[model samples]
Target: MPELPEVETVCNAIRKSIKTNKIKEFVIINPKLRWNIDANIKKLLSKVDIRKIYRRGKYIIFNFNHGSLIIHLGMTGIVKFLKNRHKVNKHDHYEIKFQDNTILRYNDVRKFGSIHWAENIEDNFLIKNLGVEPLSDNFNYEYIKKISKKRNVVIKNIIMDQRIVVGIGNIYASEALYMSKIKPNKNCKLLSTDNFKSLVKSIKKVLQKSIKAGGTSIKDFQSIDGSPGYFKQKLLIYGLEKCACGKNIKNIRISGRSSFYCSNCQK
Candidate 1:
């Protein structure tokens, strides 16, 4: 699935190109997605100007004159731009054609992605309950410490929770834990204030680095330009069986997601 960095990459890649474009039409090749695309969405967005493109959590938000379009690129989704005359492929489920003869297409092989309309993003159900962005000022060490002190779950699971902190996916969770020298499965209550401080710093550092590298292309993630992300080459231990410390990296499942860590390097 596309995480925060990947989502942000998509948002940034298409923002300048799509902004101020006049929407000529909206097409739903299929309405069967993780959430069904509303039938009235085409009429709602007809001929509106695209004000902006932004990201909140893993969802891409397309701002318009009267409302917003929220898109979740579930597991195998990629949003890209193409010519208005471009041929539609098998997985191209949604599209918006601009009067400039360009098209913004959303393709998802797994059909887990979704498109929804919101009068105001702040009042939308999907946007209302999201936690703080990892790169924002609100996610500093002090804030992380406060949230960590209240959780008894494994620190890995704690950070992965969308409600606790948004956008730390499985790969990032492992890398950040390894960077902080904190074991993935360690109970959150066992971590001291200093540990939380390090963890917060590691989280921010790893996320920033990943975003800079264009995000990790583990499976199906890709930029809007049909290019894969480069961060996978810099992974520390997410898919490795051995660590640089000459000790075997451990693989464990927490909350049914694979977590990698060096038993020696991490506590």
Candidate 2:
């Protein structure tokens, strides 16, 4: 599944093509998704002008006056902009034809992605409960401390929780914990203010680096140009057999997600 950085990359890639463009048509190849698409969505979006494109968590928002279109690239999904007459992949389940003849397509092999129409994006069911953006001012050490109170889960799980901090997925949690020299399985209750402060910094740094590197592409993640993310090459601990400290990196499952850390380095 595409995480925050990947989603942001998509937003950046699609922005120019989508913003201020008039949708000539909404082509629906398959309406079956994780959340079924409304049959009339195509008709509803016809001729709608796109004013902006952005991301909230893993969901992409295509904004216009009085309405917004939300999309989630659940897993194995990618959106691409192609020339008007380009070859279409079989997984191309949704499409938008701009009045200028630019083609935007959403393809998902697993069909787990979704599309939604919302009159108010902030109040949409999917957007309402999402936690603060990891890159925002709201995700400081104080906020982490406030949310960690009485929470017994592992530190990795805590940060990965969308309700606590949005978009720090499994990959980032492992990298951040490793960077901060903290164990991924460390209990949230066992962490001190200093520990939380380190974690907050580490998370922000790791995420920013990944975003700059165009997001980590272990599998099924690519930019709108079909280019795989280059961040995986810079990954420190994830998927590695040994750490820089020359110790074997531990691979443990916390909350059913694999976590990588060097026991010799991370506490």
Candidate 3:
């Protein structure tokens, strides 16, 4: 699945070309995705001018004159802007035609991505519960400390929880834990203030680096321009089971998700 950095990259690329463009039409290739397309969406967005594009967690918000269009790029989903009409692929779920004749295509192999019309993005259920953005001022060490006190979950799971800190997915979580030199299996309550501070810094550093590198291209992720991210080349321990420490890194399952860490370095 595309995480925050990948989503933000798409948002930026789309914003440059699509902002202020009038929506000429919308085509829903898959009927399952048009649950309320006609009644709720068409009435709200047809011919509306796109105001701006922003991201909340992994979702992209296409702001318009009346309501905003919220897009979640679930696993195996990609949104691209095409200069001309082309043959639709098997998973092309939605398309938005712009007044300039340029079309934005949404393709999802898993059909898990969604598009919804929202009057106020902040009040929407999906956007309401998301935790603070890692890049925002609200996501400091103190904030992490406050949330860490709520449960005895592993630090890895605690950071992965969207309710505690949004956008820290499995890949980034492993990288951050490794950077902080904290064991991925450490309980949240076992983290001291120093640990929280180091973890918070590592989270920000890892995420910023990934964004700069255009996000990790693991599996099906690609930028709007169909370019694969290069961050994977810089990974320290996420997929390196026989890491450089001469001691093997352990790959364990926690909360049913795979976690990677150097047993020698991350204790």
For model 3, residues 130-218, the per-residue Cα lDDT tens digits are 99999988999999888788888899998898877888888889999999999999988889899999999999998899889888888
Cα lDDT tens digits for candidate 2, 181-250: 8998888888889999999999999888889989889988999988888899999999999999899999
Task: Give candidate 2's root-mean-square deviation (CA, Å).
Answer: 1.4
Worst 10 residues of 1 by lDDT: 14-23
lDDT (tens digit, per residue) of candidate 1 on 117-156: 9998899988898899988889887887787787789999
lDDT (0 to 1) per candidate? 0.88, 0.87, 0.84
lDDT for model 1, please: 0.88
**Candidate number that wins on lDDT, 1 or 3:** 1
Task: Write down the TM-score for model 2.
Answer: 0.96
Tell me the TM-score of model 1.
0.96
